[model samples]
Target: MLLGSPTVTREAAVWRRRLGGNPFTVAPYALSCRAAFRAHRGSFDARWRRLQQLAPLLSSTAAEEGGSLRFVPEAPTCCQAHVYLRGDAAALDAARDAVLRERGVRVYSRLRGAAVGPEADECYFELTLGPRHLEVADAVYVGAWRAFFAALAGPQPGGRKGVGDAEPQS
Candidate 1:
């Protein structure tokens, strides 16, 4: 089911039509959802609790970056944490690539709706603490983010100024 404001739902429908047709041929089996939830309720609850605990820590860590990065919602109520990085898009992309290539963790870089525009030199990425993450310590994730921001702030190979070194755009 599509959940959104009327305008958003209408736009989604328009895109759906433009794309040819609805992706799902058959509606999802409701009983399967019920069965899965029942079977994995404990795991789901644990992940939810972990996410709740991690959000504040991640927010505080982002706060320490001195304004280069920030959590979008400030307080997220879901499993995924959305972070907005204010800097050159290319540099942001490089940093994201470096983090995934070097650290073996994936942080998705995609922002929709009002988050993107010609006026802002910023990028939004998502970090999620999934089931595999539950096996690791929280400090690992925090440290990885710190390293990513540092990479964004540090000098590039071709002597390009990092976001922290560049003059702030008006």
Candidate 2:
């Protein structure tokens, strides 16, 4: 039987504290990573439709305030989805976990990282789909993230970034 999963663990919390709250550590130990995606070739209308489908699933106050959907998956993993947002990262992280849990889609918050541009620093929350046995969740996360990209911004040519079109990482 499948066992219950946790969104965040005390071990992770302790490690975070140990690293002085820096998401990026010098060691870079193995972590359950999620895949990131960019918008793919698609019509603007098609992209809008995909955004509509995703609007309810994801949590974004910016989108609610007549702002654009800024959720971008740019993590270096192949089994998680990363979202960048402004405002309380903790709250949004919890909200995301709750939303996915309600849909029976379990995920874990892997890391919170700094963004590149005008976005908030330490604003991105990387979420892993499930544990090792849940390869199906990994596939779903990849497909959904890809569709999300295709619908919202359209991924650039040459397929998804990070993982470099490689087979799923362990």
Reference-based lDDT, residue 165, model 2: 27
Model 2: pairs clashing at backbone N, Cα or C within 3 Å:
34-77, 34-80, 35-80, 38-155, 39-154, 39-155, 40-154, 40-155, 47-151
lDDT tens string, model 2, 1-170?
11344545656667778878655652343242222122322333443444344434444433433222344543222333455554444544454444353344433343355454365543555443323333243346444333333322322466632221234579
Candidate 1: the clashing residue pairs are none
After superposition, the stretches of candidate 2 with alpha carbons farther than 4 Å from their true spots are 1-82, 114-117, 127-170
In the range 1-170, model 1's lDDT, one tens digit per residue, is 67999999999899878886654632356557777768766676567668777777766776685435565566656666666667666766666666776687544554432336333766666766556768868877787676677667686567644444555589
Compute each candidate's TM-score over C-alphas: 0.61, 0.29
Q: How many angstroms is residue 6 displaced in model 2 relative to the true structure, after the best TM-score fit? A: 44
lDDT of 1 at 136: 69
